[model samples]
Target: MSDFRADTVSGKLTTFMHRARAEGVAEPVRHEAKRLILNQLKASVGATGQQAVRLMLDWAMAEAQGGGGAHVHWFGTSLPPALAAMVNGALYEVLDFHDTYIPCFMHAVSGVLPAVFAEAEAGGHSGTAVVDALAIGLEVELAVATMLMPTGYYRGMVPAGLTGGVGAAAACALLRGLDASQTQHALGLAMCTPAGIYEAAGSHTLAWITGNAARTGLQAAALASRGFTAPPTAFEGDQGMFKTHSDEDRAKIDGILASLGTEWRIFGQTYKVVPTETITHGPVECALAILPRAGGRVVERIDIKVQEIVVTIVDGRRERFGRPSSTPQATFDLCHCVAAAWLRGQFTTAETSAPCYTDAEVIALSDRIKLTADPGRPTFEGCTMTVTFADGSSESHNVDYFLGTPNARVPDSTLIDLLEQYGAGVLPAGRAHAIADAVLTLDTAPDIHGLIRLLNKD
Candidate 1:
């Protein structure tokens, strides 16, 4: 194996992605990649009718009214490659049900999948090619994120939009069969276009950040493919990505490069069983676990002790916890999710909507929940919940790992079931099953266009 760390970060990544092969990837890694792809498709199809997705599709379609390029998965429409990527990417993230990389605090699939799908459809690439590009894209995104951590989110910048653009660009470059230099230029161009804020959490604009990242990335790769030039040191120079976006004087660039092809971070990605912020999942699980113990007794107060990250991101918005006006606000509130899960026994996509958010019973229970940061708790994956009944009795439950974490990964059957459930809302049962089957065996499919076609609603 060559020393990928010896080259510039961008150069090293370009070489790795350009040379990546499906056959070279381990079976388990490939399986995980397929699951991630399927998860993204499931999210896209599930959120097809969302107001945010509809708005983005309308805008993208209008932008590409005369020039058609590639298919937008599940929408049965074609737009220019960049516009298609934008719509598909927005759909993947609009529901906040996509896969997440814990280390980077980013949505791993939404950012990269749209670019890969768009480029593959436009170029008529194979499923193997799409898989390879996805793996490469994830690797680059994870590595960069790992290096710039402990600051991006703290500074109000959304990691998915900040780092996702470069990841999408890398995937597009690989699909376009660009040389190492061109791929480097693509990353450079993408690095200059980062735009997403933590404040977008409770609005439709949050999804737009994800969509814009996908579009910008595909556009960057397209420009690079056409001999566009960018500085070679776009990621490491005095005014590079790290300097501009990170508070760290020097990022762990060496460590990021050294682990390029040796480690597969995709295996560590977690699926969102609930349609809310990933940090709230543990608390939601805790709430559900204690529900049975509480029996028919009325709950008086619930105290939740979570990690610092949770308090920073989910607890600050106390006003929205009791009564959220929208799905985004409700999903961002830990108390709202816990209350809903406790009352309904499960948190599904429907629970994140306006009707559920404004439920009188849910609001009453949510108002009683109090959240506090546990300084000793190291990560946001675990939470301790104590619920006191009206009769003064109390029950406590601690959750160290949620359902979709690496330790408690959702089974393939559960994933298929989720896909069927979500897909059935938009697609026929037969079509949903067909789409699932094709995605499960996607590695062997001759062309990715067939898979995209199956995703269309008949």
Candidate 2:
């Protein structure tokens, strides 16, 4: 395999940006991307008041306002675009409620858009430009993430912060109309600002890293727009990103970028059927879907087959499973998800965030659940669930795909309804409806400023 780590990956990124900017995206894909963006905006805004989100936004807003370098529009408020991007990015991720891709372990849109929106708004780019930038950033981030999947990096390393800076840079380069060389410079600048850590997973640091990635990505790209430059060999060469942050599989890296435009990475973006939990646990949801059949009273032993990485992240915090104190803990807890599903018959944002997380009954049930990695199952998908009852009867269900994913796409109407459901908690009913409508109609809008404005409407 060729050493992609030693090659000019930044230059390749520049070339790809040129092709993306010049060729542009298909109308259909652009529309889909807009819809996804709208969904993410709603999700982020809805999570704005969350404790982790508030902390992240507070820091980001202070940083941008403190820096006073640029003015930008925040999604839900009149904050600077850079600040807004950072805060909104953080908010979107606070609940870990945003979209995720299985192959790359990347939180796809949320990480890139905050920066993209910030830069686009700051630069006064058109909605079409915003969409283009968003698509470019999304593609680049997904490409990098897909290239590095199944490696140790997937454990807790935020792919968004790592690759998102590059994505944001790509978007900024495209939006700013930078040339190929300048785009390379932007990418290099982005790589310098790789921000994320697995240690922040169970804490508020996850949101901070996400928001920071967005802000830094925008900063990097914005710098490149004005002719600022950094080391050209950021992604490749001896002292590059991969050698330091990840185990570089040169073949995978090259292959990820090889079939670029011909194969759309946008297709890899998967929406969430359930608003909580990481994408790695989607199949757990599939298993939980059948728990209602077992009857709430009879579930004696619950055995779940999950990916090893899922087990690692979820293993810690068994006490949380038994008694979830926070929304983040409840959502990320396998015991909570399954226990709630069996007891309440559903897994919605409301259920996970409910006071029931601390309820004795839920915790009692959670204690009965057990999760084990299925060696036969791929890390990306597939989950088998068995519910053995006290009545000497057992029921098992296996789900190959979650509600999201290309294999089982959520209906547009249903997804809209789900967004409305989430938005209703934070926004007025009419406002939520309008937001959903605006998202669906985002493609035809003149600019995302209006969309951003719409998202912030309480």
Candidate 3:
């Protein structure tokens, strides 16, 4: 056994992650990585004109000190690799429509792909290289999340922000071709910068946290490449990351490292079919299913039973759920999402923002929705919606798996259609289709620069 096996949790993880990055991953892993990258790019394009994305891009560009190395998606400008990663990472998440890992409730693509694309573009890496780095990064991130589960969120930490830096740093290190020790240093540096609180949800600061993770990861890798040192046992000591962020007595380091590269966690990731919270997707689907039976009748009441975790995260704040003033707030409000779906028969970006948010019908229906915790329902993977019509008739639907869950992967044709639907008006004519075609065949592309070029508006 390696010395790291008996040393500490961080040591073992660092060693395992370095080894995993060095080895060749499966073709499916690479394909999934490409899909995740494409998904994030699509989301970035869709959010190109959003106020949050515009503000953050401007802030990132202003902070650039002339060391332009990489491009920001859809912005048509180059910035320092770290700054570019920050801007693009935040853009990937501005719509809240990125790929998520169900187990960790972390948006894996938003956390890792921004840094991977930035570093790959800066170094003139190939498309295959980008996929490889992303796969490795996601593996490291999911492992970290799996080990720290049930506590990270309970402690009010945002999963993406809490674990994103390490994932992004791992991808950066791989793209830079760092060895085990250097990768360890990169992870240690990343651990020092973990941030994002649950309280930041429903605010512009949420996107800022996502961007900070990408920037911090790139900076950590850059520093580590120059022989910067960090404590080896950064995750298991008394004052380590795991101890500080989680209530666990000791890190589940060995268990997390044991399955690295063997069981690909990337395969279990879920893509978002809508621009809303993952937990709300199932409930929205349930409401949509019941919409057809209502026949345009007034909804007298809506009774929703969901897992306790869902209530805690999405419906915990009565005032916010009752009346959402902002897009972010509406996205997290289950009642709002279900109500919108019931009224419109679909929940999209349009429903989460503006006139739709303040629509009288949506507000009236949302107020009638009563959310209750179901102790028997262990996971947010499913929810049941009961709609009581004014005529004293009721309809109920239960959704065990939403469209993009691992058990119910979105069909490629449907996903492509959604890409076009979401990208309409945002991307120039035919631009979205061309980008999708390139991403579908990303492995054959000579370089990622050609792909990045497609993202820029002419």
Candidate 4:
């Protein structure tokens, strides 16, 4: 069963799986996985009340009450494994507050957790097993995403849709106890299913893509277990994934496959402080730094100079910058995000709502927001923000790295508090901490029963 041809992407992924399964996870790696898991669950719990999330949950609850399949966490409903992953995956991304792998601009944990947890819970996998699956799955997800990004992102491809299912498939195959060959086939099938377009981010189509990637992963793995076959050269062939999405130099990607499992890509994931796009993080930091001087002032002009790609994606919905109609739209409008935060002297999830997006004062300020992209600026981690008041006084700040990025990491305590804060609002009393505890201690624990199973005992 070990017929690894190093030139093929499937072979490379197979070797990655073999090494991980044989070696298990190191302590630090497992801890990182726990941190990623807790953060994703936090995002899922916080977004449970979103209109889109509620709509999906209402649809899933119909079949989940019977308890013969995987249970959808945060909703107390059970559905088939694939469907469970689909619903949970949508919740993970509907909020856009989850972790983003900065290199690829993808929410690294969103799609993978849904598939990993759904399969783990359905298969009665232990906490250790779940953590292993998550680490491996997220690692692969970020890897493929790295191989496609910058070029793929600029090509109008959604990074999460392109890599989420592939990561999920790798994890699901592990849970289903498939061989490396079967795992590669699952990866190939998963590779064939990435269809999300970057143009649909603020619309409902993003939720569909996120959910479909999660659903496809579980289904792909199940199909692979039944002798399903896929192209072995699906990743780096002449017309493979690499060629289809990106025009990056082939030399940079030539040795990429052999590099798997050496240094995990899971470490590249960035946690968000506010529920806005990652591109807004540094600019928001720059905005907040100068807000004390510019607060309560009538704006003559607001300018943020950032990398060109930031403008392409974060400010992609330029028309909605001053007239956002929904939460999703508000989260993507860099102009609105800074203007509203400038007016309020702070930015929080509240800014991503109707009251903030439609506020007359916020609109007046956002309408003056001018996002200038500097083509020479190539980094995603820095930006310059300038605010000019009607009095002709201007305040400016330059940020090198925002908190929550790899260089400037949000503390683990802050992330734990994020989850606990959700308990006070959305989840049941203490459910948030309970989930946090389960994730934090997962590697040494017995099982994931506390995470996905519904316990009725008083």
Candidate 5:
């Protein structure tokens, strides 16, 4: 309601987050916040044993042996909040199972939660406090992302990396109870390094970017609390990021600002039913359905019709876009994902990893796949797939809304089971279940120490 946009992007986002913390998140939205946390925990902790996690953890232990008091989620190593943020953030990304904001293809809650948990744990903040900060943090993150997406994406900017720090900064500042001015400064400082590109997907660098964004937010909030300041025009001036990263549409920026408190961008999010790329969910589900009907036919071709974003990301001109070169790239390759899932008869996290990715049959099927963009479909989640056989017969299946989408939401009971399953991958038995329980009661819980312990405990 206040004049959030009169100053710069920093001031506006700060006002939006600060105002929400003051009024407290609405009950329904707080429940949704809890849902995001549970999903993030499931997604992140499940990836603790990954190569990316090992790399970050080894670095944290070696360099941050005596950094500070913040404990890494799932690893229990004590380090500075910034370093802890890095490891936790990387965990969210390595699996590529986290939720994405459809509008920007940026991770909705992954980057921000690491910052929230780091600040909350280090400062001993309450879970009720976490829900509020997490909600506000995500609100600002999604807000900033909405202003830049599609256009920014068109310009080769990665949304999570570019907008992630701003979201993280907002959450940390709110948890630390920084005043509006300092919060604005934190936002500006957090935007200093927004490095992400489409090419980084398979290099193990994409996950690290998420980690760096979390670290950026934690450091920005910490420095701002002690009087560190960044340029007021960091985002919108002549040589600013708005022009550099996005299409610089003034109306899009202004519209998100106006919709801030009332509209709730966080509510618009859709969680992934499958662990692969978000846009690939509908197609994977469609492919899996079509596979059962194929019976004994030898598949000659696999035709996929997706939304425009899929085509933009996978033009099929490049070999890597059509055929994955590595495990991480395979997660994003539409053809590989569809082929692998159809052959395996399931599209779980296992299908995205080794042996399965390198399997001969999967690669053969992926080569047979072709993608077409459907102009009529407006959203990123739906797709139509047709599988042709050697007998000159074909079958097609269309998916409008797969499970875990906002249109067809995954039930909380199902999500609870999912969290337990993912958490059990690296955790002791019953640990993940306890983690899910803590999240369900998070709104009323006194502090997040118990949840942190559940994640960090041996």
Candidate 6:
């Protein structure tokens, strides 16, 4: 039994995987992983037409020209699974549409899945194995993230990409069936590659950084599988991952991981049902439910009160919540979300596309909106809004938590609905349902790649 420090991503991952496997993952855990994987697949495929996606695919294809070891096929290409995993993972993240865990505060799945799928396909692992690996990766990433999240958000570390590196490595290690020693080393190898900045949140590079983690993780695990080794204390020792990235309280991460066996961390993984924006903005969507209570009154003033992190992340943007001109911008900008929802009377995914681009009212309303920071609240909470009408009336809505937290989790049916709607535009309708059903029952499936194959375009 190794004792790991609080800030060490590698230490937390190693501990959680051992515990997750011991407790025996529940069916709901696998189902959630399936739902997230389906979402990532759709987002990856949809990204093919984006300029960033094309650019990344071009570079990846060039990288694919020569590689060794196993053939890990990507989703949309004839390339081997490993290479495809790199591309697919990158694509999933290239758009920043993948699921995120708030506790660990990282984009865990996007980076890890490509590697898991690649290895699962290469070695012909069962869907159960893939599901287990995903759960393990997410669990580990979230646990480590929880410790690092508090201080890092203010210090400029992009928690998702930072912790995602280790998660990706863990998933790949699971796929490769690596021993514990190798697993630890693979994580160490990944810790050395963590990259991404919070400043990049609004830009196209955000998704690519996430995907890059996948590629890096897969390569690290593959190298380790072939008897490569790195520093075992990659995360823990002096001059290591935490020392370089984190600024907050040191021991919080370790204390959380210590609860790994007794507490199932997967239960903490949050899901985003509304495609509106970032994790901080999820509560804003719920707050929008109160607009009708305002009696459709014209608002003289609108004030959004959120944790300081959200204010810092979204306030400076030219149109953070207005209609986003690009895909990347829409995820973080709350102004675009509020403007669209108010103008259209609904904020569907399509609204984030071109139609919202042409709406003048959304633009005008976005200009009127003002955002204020609440220093007293937690970043995960205080995503609230207040509207004051021209008449002598006002309404205040406070979302103490986001929609996808353990207390306010998105239902399984809602997750299924989201998958169907998100995938229906690209994949056949029946195929979308099948993807959901198959994912829900993945534990009994023959191989995980079978589900990956179903995600292919006809």
What value of lDDT does candidate 5 attain over all alpha carbons?
A: 0.81
What tens-digit string does per-residue lDDT give for candidate 4 at 274-326? 77878888888888888777657867888888888777665447743436888
TM-score of 1: 0.95
Best by lDDT: 1
| TM-score for each of the candidates | 0.95, 0.90, 0.95, 0.93, 0.95, 0.87
The per-model lDDT (C-alpha) reads 0.82, 0.70, 0.81, 0.80, 0.81, 0.68
Reference-based lDDT, residue 326, model 3: 86
Cα deviation of 274 in candidate 2 (Å)?
Answer: 1.4
Q: Give the residue spans of candidate 5 off by over 4 A.
A: 1-6, 316-318
Sliding window of 10 residues with minimal summed lDDT for model 4:
449-458
Per-structure clash totals for the candidates: 0, 4, 0, 1, 0, 19
Model 6 stretches astray by more than 4 angstroms? 1-23, 39-48, 66-75, 279-287, 293-296, 318-325
Tens-digit per-residue lDDT, 1-458, candidate 1:
32223267788777777656533666677788888987776666778778888888888778887788787877789889888888888888888888988877889778888888888888888877778788888888888777777687778788988888899998888888887778888998888778898778888898999988888888999999898977777788788888788885463678768777888888889987777888889989898888888879999999999887777665567643435888878878778888899989989877888788889999999889888989988777788999999999999999888889988888777777778888875787677667778887877888787788887887
Q: Write one digit per residue (lDDT tens) for candidate 3, span 1-458.
A: 22223265556666666676557777888888878876777666778877878898787778885669898887778998888888888898888888888887788778788888889888998777778888888888888777776688788898889789998998898889877777788888888679998788788888888988998888888898898977777776667788888875453667668888789999898888888878888888888788888887887899989988777665555544447888888877878888888888888888988788899988988888888898888678788889888899899999888888988887666666777787777678888778888887877776788888988877
Instruction: Supply candidate 4's per-residue lDDT for 75.
Output: 67
129-149 in candidate 6: lDDT tens per residue? Answer: 888888888777666677667
Q: Give the TM-score of candidate 2.
A: 0.90
